[model samples]
Target: MNSITVLGSGWLGFPLAQLLSKEFSIKLSTTSSSKFENLKDENIIPFIVDINNLNGDIDKFLSSDILIINIPSKNIDGFKELIKHILNSNIKKIVFISSISVLKDETTPLLEIENLFKKTNLEITILRFAGLIGYGRNPAKFFPNGKVVKDADTPVNMIHRDDCINIIQKVVKQDIFNETFNCVAPSHPTKKEFYTYCAKVSGLPVPTFDSSKNESNKKTVKSDLLVSKLNYTFIHEDLMKIVF
Candidate 1:
């Protein structure tokens, strides 16, 4: 078992900390000073530290065998300094919790970071996730109008809370070096199609399709490799009906 450190102990980080601590030594870090007690109660070693405010304590944090970067893209700039600092530490492996948004319509900085990790001693694993829909964390919040994007035919990719943690557990055990996997549900449903389903299920009004430019383009995510290799099955593949 490795000494694991999760950098951002938020929603997904808490679960990952719990998952990893069962088999490894865990040190979960977060910006929240108040949450560390809960983490300690959960049997996780909690460190209330912010990467942005670090003054060399990063070296202390990277003292683990594996460093899991759970901070979001808004803090991606910190990653540049983080990778540099990790090289100076005892850590040998890294797992970055990135998002499937990188695969969207724009060029992303992840590819560059992926290349940076590849050149180092740090054996890195990148988990690119899709729409994360858990209890209070709902994607429906983004589409509050009970309407999805214009491309009604565009498929929606999602993975449940339990499945994400489970897959991360499995992937770490493999000791695979420098692997990037898209973490998403196996099912893909059209945008409008799924939205209407959710609206009906949630007892909300079925939004009128405006036939606007957005209503016509298809956006999909690919994760065939994750499913075939890990045998990952999603608990909530289609939330449009169940979540509402």
Candidate 2:
């Protein structure tokens, strides 16, 4: 059996471990002690680890064939030490769960971290995910009644949490390494239409968007590379189905 160590076990990582545990031996970590029992009960070897302040035998957490970096952190001060530790370990492959925010015109700290990983010739796969939505993370709650937002006509790039997990699994199983995958739903729903439907379905007040905003300001992330490269299909491609 293949052993995989997931560095962070939060909203996306916890469910990901649950789904992959059936086949692969999952060694999961969390920053919270309260989650240990639940993870252990699910047959996951749980460890309390904080990436920002890493302590204990780092080897114990990384003693696996593969490592999945799921922690979302803006601090990269200790990141070099973390990289050194991973390089010293026997673990060879890495799957870094990144956000699409790095693509924005502004320079982001995550991009710097990613560039550092690219500099090292390690077998790493960077999965840049779009706005994540599913279960408790409904987009309807973000905009309140009579709230005015900008860039209403821009395309919304989003993916269901389930799809994110599925895409990660596919990348691991296929041994896809040293590549970047934009993990997003194929549907390109305009912000106005999508959020309007969300508010209507959830009985929330519909928010208005400024139509005068420049179209160039809006950003749309494409996952054509992910689809073609991974040969994967999205389960929830339409935002309409997502709202209902």
Candidate 3:
């Protein structure tokens, strides 16, 4: 069986590792030791890894056939150090979990970190995800209580957590690497329409947005490349159908 090491087994990482465990040997990492037994219960090899002050045996983590990096950090300098360390590893295939926020703003700090990998020869697959919603995360919480959220007419670009895992699984199985793909739902709903509905369902104060705002310059992120290239179907294509 192919061995896969998942760095940063948190929200998305934990479920992802669980799903992939049936098909591949799983190695999961956490910053806290408290989560070790939980990971172990799932039949996953658990390790304590702190990228900020990495003191663990990195060689053992990179010993797998592939590495899926799900850690989130804004410290560019610290990421540069991690990049340098990873470049020295024997691991060749890497699946980097990034966000689509980099698309709207190229100056996003994560983009700077991602660029460092572009300089390397490793097979890198960068997944730029949209606003992640599912499970513990609810978009209603972001709108706050009766606060005016700008871009009311601007279409919301969001992706479900299930889709995120499915895309990664497809990427690994198909051997697709060295590319950046926007991972989001195809349908785009205006913020006012989407959030108002979300607030009602969650019993939160509905957010207000200017109805007169012009949406001519608004850009809806296109996430068709992955579906087109990999022929993978999104489980939650319509955000309205999602149950919180």
Candidate 4:
């Protein structure tokens, strides 16, 4: 069986590692030692890795055939050191869990670090996921009862955590690499429509939007490349259907 190492066992990484453990020999990394036994109970080999500090047995963690980096840290120097270690290790393929936020701003650290990974010789796939939703992470909760939310007309670029995991699984399983793809739902709904529905479903107070703000050039993300290249279908394509 092929071995895979998942760096940063947080929200998305933890569940991803759990699912991948059934098919591949999985090694999961966590910054906290408290989660070590939890990972073990799920049949995932655990490692205490802190990329920001460059601490832990990274060499051993990189022993797998494939590496999945899901950390939220944006430290350029830390990733620089991690990349150096990767070049020296047995990790031939990498699936980087980037964010669509990189497109929103050029100054974003993820874009700079992404460039660093692009120059490497190893096969790498960069998945830029939009605002993560699902698994009790409802967007409605972002606004309190009477909080005024802006961008009422602006379209929301978001993805479900389940779809995020499935897309990564497809990329790794199909050997898709050296490509950058946006992971977002095809349905682009207005923030007001989406959040109002979410709030009603979750029994939360509906957020009020500021209609005074005119959003002519609203930023919306598309997953055309992902759909075309991976031939993948999003499980949560309709944002309105998402229930908490």
Q: Would you estimate the TM-scores of all the predictions?
A: 0.85, 0.94, 0.93, 0.96
lDDT per residue (tens digit) for residues 1-244 in model 1: 5688888877888878887887888888878778865444455777776766666566777778888888764544666777788888888888877788767634577656666677786788888888776657644445665444565556777767777787778778877547789988777776667667766756666765544456334566767888777776766665554563
Give the TM-score (vs. native) of candidate 1. 0.85
Task: Assess the local accuracy of residue 231 in candidate 2 as a C-alpha lDDT between 0 and 100.
Answer: 88
**Model 1 lDDT on a 0 to 1 scale:** 0.72
lDDT of candidates 1 onward, in order: 0.72, 0.85, 0.85, 0.90
What 10-residue stretch in candidate 2 is worst by lDDT?
A: 35-44
Segments of candidate 1 deviating more than 4 angstroms = 40-42, 75-77, 145-148, 213-217, 238-244
Residue lDDT tens for model 3, 55-153: 657667767878899998777776677667677776788899999888767888889878887888889999999999989899988866567888788
Clashing pairs in 1: 150-214, 150-215, 150-216, 151-214, 151-215, 151-216
Error of 2 at 74 (Å): 1.5
The digit string of per-residue lDDT tens for model 4 on 1-244 reads 2899999888899899989998898988888889866344555788889988776588998999999999999999999999999999999999999999888789999999999999999999999999999887889889876889787888989999999999999999888999999899999988889889999999988988886666654888899999999999999989999888
Report the number of the highest-lDDT candidate. Answer: 4
lDDT score of residue 103 within candidate 4 = 86
Better of 3 and 4 by TM-score: 4
Residue-level lDDT of model 2, residues 1-244, one tens digit each, is 2999998888999989988898888889888889865444455788888878889757788888999999888678767778888888888899999999888844888998888788886899999999989878888878766678678888889899989999999999999998998888888888898888888898878887887778675777889999999888898988778853
Q: Which stretches of candidate 4 lie over 4 Å from their true place?
A: 40-42, 214-217
Return the clash pairs for model 4, or none. none
